[model samples]
Target: MMRLTRRTEYGLMALAWLARAGGRFHSVREITENLDVPRRLLAEILKDLSQAGLVEAVRGPGGGYRLREDPGRLTLGRIVNVLEGPTIFAECYQGDCDLSPRCTIKRGIGEVARRLEAVLEDFTLEEVVHGPAGAPAPSPSS
Candidate 1:
């Protein structure tokens, strides 16, 4: 069963929180408090996002983190890739398959991976923050 890692989930949560802030900086403490995420993990996730150029880290008294690009322009796939690396959600495709030499299901797994990517590609950060509507309200309750 494929699933989003805790790190990716935290990254998305942090992104949506920042998105709701409307370009304002929010500290890790604030984000974790609002989302009930762990401080250490959330900090690492934010650092990864900052290094990936999705969010900018500000330095000063009010310094924190801000989105580098429009939330709408950022894709879920991009975020996942940044936090988790290129994911197939399966070890087989990552060259960890011990049955590769005799496996007959590789082709089907590849197809499944492609379909998953296609679906993920359709979802943008904006959709994650605001849903399908142009603007409503951010839901970081998750």
Candidate 2:
């Protein structure tokens, strides 16, 4: 039952839309209206993205949001980490686990999470918005 949280989904969608604008400032209202997303939620997501240094926010009447970094270099894993923190494939992987001394598969699960992160890091924002053919996503080992 693993799936992306709403915050992550909205963040990605907003980023993809912003990527389409070619770094132009896009207002929250504009994005919400076009994407049919909740205004408050989108605003919060944008704020998180802004704080993450992924997007730049401009103030004043002619202000909005624009991509600060190149989408082609940004990875989904980086965005997820910024919005949702690190990915935990298993609860026992946490260092505070009481059974850490006797636990088995802990390292294996850690490896799973690590490999998953590596796979996600391979995908850039440009590939998310456009086609994967634009740039090759990295493999689990790469």
Candidate 3:
């Protein structure tokens, strides 16, 4: 089954936390303490986000990381890409298979991956964590 990796999951959680923090810098310590994510891993993820221009980072005691772009405008696909490259729904999607020359499932599975990616591109981070108007996000089961 398709699922998010731990690294990508943590990235999303950290972004959601920063979004809830409003327009203020929050240190890694504070983020780690609250989110319970590992400091080292979170640091690496934040660096990637910062390099990707998704987050603004500052050094110094009072310096921290914050969203560079509005969360409402940040797509989930973009975030996932920044943190984890791209979505791979199945092995055949990568084109490394020896069976690619005559693979029957490759085309169909690739289409599904593309469609799912389009959905991700349209769904913003804010909407993912909070419903349209600050309503609690509905679980996938909903």
| lDDT top scorer | 3
How well does model 1 score by local distance difference test?
Answer: 0.83
lDDT of 3 at 101: 76
RMSD of 3: 4.7
Clash count for each candidate, listed in order shown = 0, 0, 0
Give the candidate number with the greatest TM-score: 2
Candidate 3 has its poorest 10 consecutive residues by lDDT at 133-142
* Runs in model 3 lying further than 4 Å from the true structure: 91-97, 132-142
TM-score of each: 0.84, 0.86, 0.84
Model 2, residue 122: displacement in angstroms? 0.7
lDDT of 2 by residue, 21-104 (tens): 664688898888778788999999899889889999997787899999899899988998898887767777766667667888
Cα RMSD for candidate 2? 6.4
lDDT of 2 at 75: 95
lDDT tens digits, residues 24-59, model 1?
Answer: 787888788888899988998899899999999987
